[model samples]
Target: LVPPDILKKMYVLRRILNPMGTVDAIEFLLGKLRETKVNAEFFEKMNT
Candidate 1:
């Protein structure tokens, strides 16, 4: 598993790679995570 520091860096990288996390291929995954109570609204507003 990635260490916390590394994981944070990876998450940052992911934001840079897809700032909105709205990639067509991952919308369902995002919705599922949201259903599980994960707070992903930050991603929705990242474009701003």
Candidate 2:
């Protein structure tokens, strides 16, 4: 497996290669993850 540092550099290079698309993709994933976390927390609170 690739080392974490090399993997990070590869991601940076990919972002540099396609800046707008990369940013948009990252934002979309972050938003989806945030929504999932909020929903999970809401359910957990309800279960308590």
Candidate 3:
């Protein structure tokens, strides 16, 4: 029931949500929002 333009935006959002996706302005913004507070333990837990 969604419009094509909205669906396209959703697809773009999905791509940006990919944790290891290619770097770009959106990814840079996401990284900035991280506050440099994520720890190695968090990554270790995710890797499991």
Candidate 4:
């Protein structure tokens, strides 16, 4: 059980380490989802 603060910092570190940030990953995933006719509820639930 990681604290939210630690999780936030980890997310920041991950973004720093990743050449492409989470937004890019989200966009790529969203594109793939579009091709698969993903549900609207899934999009609504997506944090991005």
lDDT winner among the candidates? Answer: 4
TM-score of each: 0.37, 0.37, 0.39, 0.39
The per-prediction tally of clashing pairs is 0, 0, 0, 0
**Mind sharing the TM-score for model 3?**
0.39
> How would you encode candidate 4's per-residue C-alpha lDDT over 1-48 as one tens digit per residue?
975755665576456447867788677656656765555443344453
Question: What is the C-alpha lDDT profile of model 1 across 2-46, one tens digit per residue?
Answer: 656555655764665575555753774465446554344433333
Which one is best on TM-score?
A: 4
- lDDT by residue for model 3 over 1-48, one digit each (tens)? 975655665566556567654666577646654744564332323312
> In model 4, which regions exceed 4 Å deviation?
20-48
Off by over 4 Å in 1: 19-48
Look at candidate 2 and give me any clashing residue pairs.
none
Q: What count of clashes does model 3 give?
A: 0
* lDDT of prediction 2: 0.54
Overlapping backbone residue pairs in candidate 2 total 0
